[model samples]
Target: MINNMNKFIAIVGSNSNKSTNRELLKYMKHHFQSQAEIELVEIKGLPIFKKSADKFVPQEAKDIAKKIEASDGVIIATPEYDHSIPAILSSALAWLSYGIHPLLDKPVMITGASYGSLGSSRAQSQLRQILDSPELKARIMPSSEFLLGHSLQAFDDNGDLKDKVAAQQLDGLFKDFLQFVNIFNQLNNAKEINVQKAKDFSWDKD
Candidate 1:
């Protein structure tokens, strides 16, 4: 049974104010309000990550991390830049993994939006690799790709998906994500070990 009170953190992977990625996440937040409580978080305005000897993490990053920690799962919406994830999103991930690993063993779902027909496929692929790293170790849902191509016209003025097929596809994937989260929660045998492993794997040493 899908938990009615499930909480999820949706990270806006773009820093641009005119981002369709944000629109997509917003749509999901409203579209699935009854299934889950989706909170959209921004990575904008976070300082570029710089390694500190003391392993300092910014307060903004910490706040986001806490939200992720408290949520049942995570959703990331990214826009392609140079055929990969944006620098701001990368910096946010660096800050997120610097000293605290909130994403360790957490369930993640990847989504992308793009102006081109190919969507942000390359960026989403790269993001999967990044989230699978030792520092993050997010259990990204397998084969759940929600790529919105020609995103400028993908949604209506009311912010709902215009295509019925695409809308149904997203609904299916979201239902799958809910099950994935539930199964992941039940299979927590390795969570402690994974967290310990992440903590022990130092960036300098690796």
Candidate 2:
């Protein structure tokens, strides 16, 4: 019984204009076009990541973090580069971990598209591990992995998944994900701790 209407921000973790990952994200947007409000976001505007404490985090980066904080769910569509996640997505996670944790306990889904047979499975696996690290904590649904392999042939000019079998399976995955969102939301609220406990256990990195 999934009744909650969640606002999800879809982020294609690549900066290239003609990215296959972006196309995949577009297909996902169309897949659930009427079910939820899906907004495609980019990370090109974010300033370069700083490692030192003296320098300040970019305002644009902060705003993006805030946006993710406010959203009910997140979708990260990444391309596998060198058998791992790209720097763009990883950099964004580092900043989001700082200045308060917006990604903390939020429901997220990771998908990837690639020209290779594995799709972005390697990148997604790495990303899932990163999500659980102290740098960030996002509640990732353990559902079907939407790997759009051979992306060039898998999608059409309009970005709709052309493969009927893959499309049907992904459609089912989305329905389950929406339900996962509701359950995850409940757990986040129900497990919220007292102020002292929150401060003691919270990985705000403050």
Q: What is the C-alpha lDDT profile of model 2 across 16-129, one tens digit per residue?
A: 888988888787787787787778889867755666654367787778777887788999998999999888888877767654467777888888888899998989999999
Candidate 2, clashing residue pairs?
Answer: none
lDDT of 1 at 15: 96
Q: What is the TM-score of each predicted model, taking all chains together?
A: 0.97, 0.88
CA lDDT of each prediction against the hidden true structure: 0.94, 0.79
Off by over 4 Å in 2: 1-4, 189-206
**lDDT digits (tens) for residues 1-206 of candidate 1:** 34657999999999999899999999999999989999999999799999988988889999999999999999999999899999999999999998899999899999999999978999999999999999999999999999899999998889999989999999999999999999989988998889899888888873
Q: Give the best candidate by TM-score.
A: 1
Query: Which ten residues in a row are the worst by lDDT in model 1?
Result: 1-10
The C-alpha stretches of model 1 lying farther than 4 A from their native spots are 1-4
Superposed by TM-score, candidate 2 places the C-alpha of residue 89 at a distance from the truth, in angstroms, of: 1.2
